[model samples]
Target: MIKYEIPETLKEHENIIKRTFRYSNEIIFKCEETKPWESKLGGCPYLKNIEEYPVDEEGEPMLFLAQINLSDLEKLDDLPQKGLLQFFVVNDDMFGLESPIVVKYIEDYEENEAQLIKENPYEDNEGYKQSLPFSNNGKMYFETREMPISSSLELFETLFKDELSEEEYEKLSRDCYSCNSRVGGYPYFVQHDCLGFDDEDFLLLQLDIDDECGIMFGDSGNCVFSIPKDALKNKDFSKVIYDWQCC
Candidate 1:
């Protein structure tokens, strides 16, 4: 929904603008102060017990990355109807990019806040965990938008010039791409190439580097996960591909 008046410079290529950028429904994560069991980026998760918490290959407790309460999000075309999907990654320099990452799904949830795990599992990383949002978590909100995604940068240029100089490309694309933290939409990448994703894949989650939350992924990088469209419909998150990149 390009509802806003187009920029004076880009209004000339309105049709190409529509075709160059793909618009999709996106659920933006609006960070807000919340309880531990609520959907959030950090803090302890809603686990039945400490045993239910996911650990890394070395048996170290993984850090809380994010938790999505499917019930909170409504009217999505390819989201689980009702459940809790939690994301956890090991505490390391790579943040489980190479190591085994964890994604948990709970069809039935526990509403009792006191019954859930409250104590942080990786207490040793208290200082490091500061990078995550311990006080607030993301609240899901929706919008329809189109932007020049990194992968389509060249296509956007082709419409105007055969090839743009480095300076021209940077200038033309300045502030034109999206860098929103969202689920189920076109992705934003610091790097142009995303080898792990393809046509059959759907953007499951994307957490962009945020200074407000003190979250960073290797110098302004973005962490993203993608799953097959069919799998998403079936609520199968077992084979998600996790990837991240920086400028």
Candidate 2:
């Protein structure tokens, strides 16, 4: 969930806001110094062999963006109980949208570090190109919570007016503290560029522009992945919609 408390202006309608937006279960990845095989934001990926490393459609090796060890997170009903979910993006300006975005699931945990991909994938120490974003190789510690995520301003305003008359809702819409690296929450984007998104879709991941983590999108922006509720419950990453934007 968002770290900031609810705005004082909307405190009166707290219950109403909560009632309107369904609380989405979320896992916040705390990026910190960690080991190689642990769930991490940027680091050497977890793979059985060299062949398992991902590459884009043009045969260029993809950069490892993140690896989420599902077993490291709380046992949420929608998430896998155990395994690793890894994300790889092309080393280009297109990121994963035009190029291929590889989302892989390792069902069984490989405990031994020696058995995993020990050698760094990138030839030099450069994880990303000058175009691709950069974040430190920090370990991911999961902080799970329920969040009342709003999709768009239009939907929020409509719901707000319904709960209370326009006169009653005398204040501006409260600020949303959503631009953080998180998972399984309703996505809030700087640009409403969600092309294939609909009501059926929920946020699978939001790798936001984290200044603290040194992660940037294009120009001070973030990316989000939306997936059908059933697709997430079934642990199906094939149909994931990946979109990133900048301010």
Candidate 3:
């Protein structure tokens, strides 16, 4: 559970603001509904404890000093209109690292521009399903591993020990697109196009050739896995993923 606090003075608020930057955890904003609640990761309903709720000395709900400033709220690109606004700070609990994020619950709130960000942030990046505080279908670009190797052959060798002949490597390393534009970093299992050249770097790795999935490496190691359309019918392909989207 996260401990919430309300800064009493501008100095305390300033300290909190500084702590936001210094903390090792990555803080993300989320709005949780109390009445018809929705998880940040989506699906089930969530309810905050009324008794354990962070309140002032008088037992009233405490609001952070910085949260009272509209200017600070404007700085957020996407803000939600309803529910309690929480800063879900990501921390590695295994190492005894705790999140210092504070949740601010308010009533009769007006909508803000920052709320435009999609709700479910784990649409494609399934890896974040466990880490994120709330559930939403938003795009997650967090890369747990390093970007793909520069050489396609090297990347192939890294994933599969078998060496690809020059001809085979050349054929697979053709003009590839990264979805709509050139997105740097890792790739995921994506759709194909009529041109045969979709957002991928390599050709389909046949089951006979390599049981594991094949990845098409792009510049800066941004890549997409090469799974045949027919393979989509198999649930295993969906389970194996290498998340490497740039922030």
Candidate 4:
């Protein structure tokens, strides 16, 4: 695990951003604006105006409009740190696993035990050979009580609207998702579904403690931090990241 002290200045700003984006935050405005043809699928929607309306492959104007709330990004400037980090899983063929593994939030122990064995056959063992424990893939979920900042713009009359090309739209969508999942100057923990592993397979994770720390797994839900274990002797809210596997 890794540990770092949260500067007092950053703590207040962090709290402000959390409270502003909270479920109870008041919506002060609602307006509509055309997503410029160039802005279609882009990550930062607030930075540019729609130049042309969107259209289909046949060159017809597409009438797909999103209803968004405007107050979500009103106080964005107050956020301490703002940027998106792409969090994705890469399959390791040497270990034999698929990409983008699903991470689940474990709620029931008894029910999950049977389901784990069914989903992961590798956990089965013969006499004298111990069975590997199932990975706790479903133990984390976020409650999006309110709309995100980027999606707050409501539908408006468009002077220049054109359909976005398929390739352009796909790239924009990916970038949009990446930005939405970004960690905003706060400490958060995200649990990923474990990949298939042999006795020696392990994870090589790069943690950004200044932004977020820690990953958890299993029934005990042991949290691994980036800070060394010995360094946690005395610290308050010491951010850390860690990794662990069953023996």
Candidate 5:
């Protein structure tokens, strides 16, 4: 959940003044519901209004901040969900002048959230399903382990061996992406994409070759498994993930 707060000092910033004017103008045009001279100024429903005052901070114009309500963060936990933020400007022209800058602010929000939830989609879901958060492609790749290898080189050998001749192996070796990091070393699966196995751990290097990578593993490799993406959306991953090993 994110809360917006405008500092009293914002009135002194040149950029803030521009944003306020733009936001105020947008609100006015929206209320009137008429198209601007330039078609670029389209209507947005989220921006409620913009207000201004006569007072100035350090000789700059005083402006009321634009109030915007972003999507409820709690409800968006999967790839198909859409989240947005909106700003209300006083008139179309005013907002047009500052659209480029204000749009940057919106993009920033998306980038920040993407990084935080890339792996742990259900971290905030309290508790519902127990499974790792994985992109559709990611889930397919990591569902099975090829075979245990004693070292990084051995792992690479297992993937290319028997399937390709010596010449083909040379070409594959040149193209293959390799990382010798401890987290994805021998005996562990390497997925093309990742899934959150826990708050701190992830299923790494599993390439979902066919998009249907679902598997359950236990001591005897006798665990029932299915694609849990549908069941896990908007639910907590911690509650659904049952077996996890960490070295």
Candidate 6:
């Protein structure tokens, strides 16, 4: 599940936009304290006893794709100007499948770069896929958390809010952090010029599982912090942008 803060600036935006997708997948978001329910449609037998499953105290229920059709973007016009939006996907069809939330910042300098190469290391690395035990065949499902017009203002606040001192910017250049586990940042251009991005990019928080690094995973969910190449000169966060997927 994803959760994030809505900055005060975004509450005043007057317009929002959306692009149609090749397919519409059903999905749902549930509170961390809620339980999963069995599908009344009678599909996916593995979830027959889903009601008896133990609750996850660490977070919330596994949000799978819902059987019921849902608008890819919901309540865009009514989001609170300043509150937490915790959203997740519930799809029983892909229940128990491998999924990882990936967060990455697109460099404006890479504007001319092929989108696929920037997003996935299809040729250079098979390491991510080596660990997977099952083949999804050729089918994949994706759901995007639609951004409202207010996002532009929120992003502006995130990128320029507090002027960073040279020393502080140096530290920020070394790593990225988010107070909310489920939120992340991305560049402003992604909202405008980047078409077909919905199928490839989504804001997600991540937890690195390796123990050697001492970094706490899931302490911050898949939320993105949008940074541009110029910000690199004065920013204190790390240069690494994560590309994550859970299927």
Q: Highest TM-score among the candidates is held by which one?
A: 2
Q: What TM-score, to 2 decimals, does candidate 6 have?
A: 0.21
Per-residue lDDT, model 5, residue 36, is 13
> Model 2: per-residue lDDT, tens digit, 1-247?
4343556656787886665453443444455655555777776777668788887777778877777776666534577777877887778766766765778878876578766666556746454545456655566656655555453434555556677656555443434445567766567677763554545676656787665567778888777766687887787888777788888
Q: Over the stretch 1-247, how does candidate 6's per-residue lDDT look in tens digits?
A: 2223333333232121122111111122222221112211111211223452222244434332112111223332221122211212222233222333211121111223222122211212343233222221111122433232222234333543464445443343222222222222322221222222222233322222222222221332121222233333333224323322221
Every model: Cα RMSD to truth: 4.2, 3.3, 21.7, 24.2, 26.2, 18.2
lDDT of 4 by residue, 21-72 (tens): 3221221111222221111111111211233223234443222111122222
**Every model's TM-score:** 0.75, 0.81, 0.18, 0.17, 0.19, 0.21
lDDT ranking, high to low: 2, 1, 3, 6, 5, 4
Q: Between candidates 1 and 4, which one is better according to TM-score?
A: 1
RMSD of 4: 24.2
Candidate 2 to native Cα RMSD, angstroms: 3.3
Model 3, which residues run further than 4 Å from truth? 1-87, 91-97, 106-115, 132-247
RMSD of 1: 4.2
lDDT of 6: 0.25
The predicted structure with the larger lDDT, 4 or 5, is 5
Kindly list the per-residue Cα lDDT of model 5 for residues 1-247, writing each as its tens digit.
1122323433233242233110000111122221111111122222212221122223322211122222222222331223332222122223222322121013223233223322222223323122212112110001111212221234346544665567655554443332221112122224212222212222211111122322222221211011244433432232222222222
Which candidate leads the pack in lDDT?
Answer: 2
For candidate 1, the TM-score is 0.75
**Regions more than 4 Å wrong, model 5:** 1-78, 83-159, 178-235, 239-247
Alpha-carbon shift of residue 204 in model 3 (angstroms): 51
- Each candidate structure's count of clashing pairs: 1, 0, 22, 37, 28, 37
Tens-place lDDT per residue, model 3, 1-247, is 1222323332323342233221011112233321222212122112233343344334433211112211222222222333432212222222101223333334344344233332222224444343332223221111111122222233333432344445543432331111321112212223222223222332211101111211122222222223333432332233222222221
